[model samples]
Target: MPTVAQIEQALFQLAPKDLAFDWDNVGHLEGSPDQEVQRVLVALDVTENVVSEAEKLGCQLIVSHHPLMNVRWHQAEMQTLRPDRYLGRLLRRLVKADISVISMHTNLDIAPGGVNDALAEALRIEDPGPMPGDETGLCRVGRLRNPVKLSDFAGEVCKALHANGVRYAGDRPVEYIAVGGGACGDEIDAVIAAGCDTFVTSDLTYHQFLDAAPKGINLIDAGHFPTEDPVCAKIVAYLEKEFPQLIIIKSTSHKEVIQYFVEGE
Candidate 1:
């Protein structure tokens, strides 16, 4: 069994804490460093359900992409210090369950063979490279083996990501593509400079789609959960290799929360 500190060390080497953005929180957020961890669970977010799953599975640690203890402006007045508040309840439960937490956010996005690499793999992009003018490597530019229609490519994005729904703009061929998982819709300029014909990401504004359409760049909003969930499996595999003696589990309770409702279905 590896200690919590040892696992954090391995994760840091993979996505160094120094690489994280100034506003971002990464690495160990809670729990004792010296505690032993034999079973680890991985998830995209540290929701209450995910915490319950870890407790049920007897996991000693949870590796998630989003930090669990983030403070929002609206939540600031909720008395997070009290055990009854939303965040406070989760924190108390985690402490009582003895489950440690490690978050890899923007650091993982920019790290080589991290979130961007996993996204490229999920889309079956060939010879993916860092997006143009992106020194941090927050996005990837790549090409499909064979060119496909923009409509067909949108379908592929939905299928590949297992998305409940997807939105797209553009009517043209697609071969060269760029991707930035999890709310990176603003990188259209960089994607264009990379010579990509299409961009796949999430949280694209209506005007953003209109702006990119006439430029001949197809934009696909694949939903944030679908865009980033692929990295969770990669994290599991990486940790499994690092700690072969321990049991690693991806959270079963973690899934896309939003569902699309079509009329007359």
Candidate 2:
């Protein structure tokens, strides 16, 4: 059984925690280096639900995409209820319960065979190239073997990734696609640079879509939660192989971020 310190060292090789932005909190928000973890879980967000799920699954550590403390934190102890309205509050609860946390954000973005490339593969892309953004290179581009209409291709991204909903811009046949996982509204440049007929990612704002519309790029916004949720299982699988004795569990909160309901006539 690998100790927490040993496991953390291994993770740094996979996705270096120092690679996280100076302002971004990325590594070891809670727990101690000396602590021994018997079980762990992974999730996109470290919400209250996530902590509860970890407890339910008997996990002492949780590796999440979003950091529990993204800003400068005063203390690690949870005295009064943290009114910050951030993931810190949840982190406090987990800390009290001795649950460790590590967030893989930007480091995961640039990691080879990581989220961007994995998403591109899920989209049925061939020879999906490196990340294309000058800043925060999470966007990946490549060609689809068979061309499909904007709507059809967007639907495929949604369906294949088990996405609840997706938003798009433009209306023609889409051949090339640029993909990024989790809130890629800022990947417009990658779309234009690659001259892709379509771009698929999560979280496209109205302003973002409008900006891309003039460029004549078909942008598909697969919901953030759905697009990145599938990777948690992969994380667990990776860690399980490394630490065979430690239990690696997946999150149970498998619901769409947006609750969509259309009234039947």
Candidate 3:
């Protein structure tokens, strides 16, 4: 049986801790490093439901993309675990259950076969490679098989990510495309510089859309969850291959936080 530290070492090979952002927490977030692990659960976020799912499935470790410990301070250490609050209650439950956790954020996004790569694959981008001027490899630039209308391209994005809806700017033809999973709208300029006429990412602001419209770069806000969730299954596959003896499961309780409901007929 593998230990938490041993699995962590394998994870590090895929998404190294040194590649993580300076402030971003990536690595063991909780539990004993030497604790033995028989099963592991992978999820996009470590929410209360994900924790419960792990416990129900008898998973000894929970590997997630977003860091549940990315707080300004160690709120989990606070004396009281308020039942009324989600964070406090979640922390208390994890401690009581003695479950281990690992979060790979920015490091996973930049790693090869990571978040951005998964997005590019889903979109059918050709010759996908790192975005120009993006030293961290956080953004990927590629070309479509043929040019398509902005609206049609957006629909393709929605289908690929299983998104409820997609918001975009610009109505021209799209060929070259760029993708940055999660909130990475800041790379719009780099996308343009890379000769990409369209950008696919999440958390695009009103001002960002306005700014990109004039530059002829169509921008699509595909929602953070859909943009990154594909990587969760990828993680499960990797872990399954790396540790065949251990049981690897993806959380059934996790789903998109945002939904698009049509108006009443």
Each model's lDDT: 0.89, 0.75, 0.89
lDDT of 2 by residue, 1-265 (tens): 5566787787777778766667667667678877788988888888888888888887888888776665454344334456484444775677788888877776776576667776876778999886455466667778888888888887788898887667777865888777778877667776677677787877778887776667778878888877777667667877888888888877777457685665682
| Tens-digit per-residue lDDT, 156-226, candidate 3 | 99998999888999866999899999999888888888888899999989999988778878999999999
Higher-TM-score candidate among 1 and 2? 1
TM-score between model 1 and native = 0.95
By TM-score, is 2 or 3 better? 3
Q: Could you give me the TM-score of model 2 versus the true structure?
A: 0.88
| Candidate closer to the true structure by lDDT (higher is better), 2 or 3 | 3
Q: Which predicted model would earn the best TM-score?
A: 1
* Model 2 clashing-pair count: 0
Clashing pairs in 1: none
Q: What overall lDDT, based on C-alpha atoms, would model 2 receive against the true structure?
A: 0.75
Poorest lDDT segment (10 consecutive residues) of candidate 2: 71-80
Instruction: Tell me how far the alpha carbon of residue 206 in candidate 3 is from the true structure, in angstroms, after superposition.
Output: 1.1
